[model samples]
Target: MTPRISALLAGLLVLTACSAGSTPAPSPTSSPAASPTAVQPASGPAITISGMTFTSPSAVAPGATITVTNSDSVEHSVTADTGNAFDVEVDGKGTATFTAPTQPGTYPYHCTYHPSMHGQLIVG
Candidate 1:
């Protein structure tokens, strides 16, 4: 075959091979970084841990049972920064609880596992 004709035939063969048994492209998918997270509003006495972060409510009822939720892949804790007012440990994708101090004031807290995670709760 001629040089030009040979080149054309090789290109046609490659195109035919590429089209044979070809499958459609897959669609885009979303990533579920956190699943079934129980995050309450800021006004409520709920604490949520996501991406090693602590999301705490503004204030809670005095001596109320505060809920602590963990959505990360590891365990976490909400411990009082000053005194033994409250301490709660939550497992991965789990929940725990602690009692709020009856004194009407801001109680700072931090995560025992992650020192960078910190927050505060007001009991009034």
Candidate 2:
């Protein structure tokens, strides 16, 4: 065989071998299944912090995801008043998230940056 033809055949074989051994890309309509673990973040409602105040959302489910949106010009945080329930810091005009406690209750949280700024999270 000609030198050029031999080179072309070898390149085609390499490509075929690579594609045959590799896994196909996932389809856009399909999603990877996740194994359940002890800790998994579940998305829920959202909390908006504007005008140096915390606007708590409606009642949330226990062990749900709590997202914080800080629209102020300064950074803020959502910190539990008592035990370490959940703490998430968000920058000015930024957002952050935290996992809610498994036990349902009224959780009072405050901004670690601004002590006067406080909010309550109602979980059912």
| Per-model TM-score on C-alpha atoms | 0.63, 0.64
Q: Any residue pairs clashing in model 1, and if so which?
A: none
Runs of candidate 1 with Cα error greater than 4 angstroms are 1-44
The local distance difference test score of each candidate is: 0.86, 0.88
* lDDT of candidate 1 over 3-110, digit per residue (tens): 999999999999999999799774456334343564654444788899999888878889988888899989999999998999888999998888899899999999
RMSD of each predicted structure: 8.4, 8.2
lDDT (tens digit, per residue) of candidate 2 on 39-75:
5554569999999999998789999887888899899
Residue 85 Cα positional deviation in candidate 2, in Å, after optimal superposition: 0.2
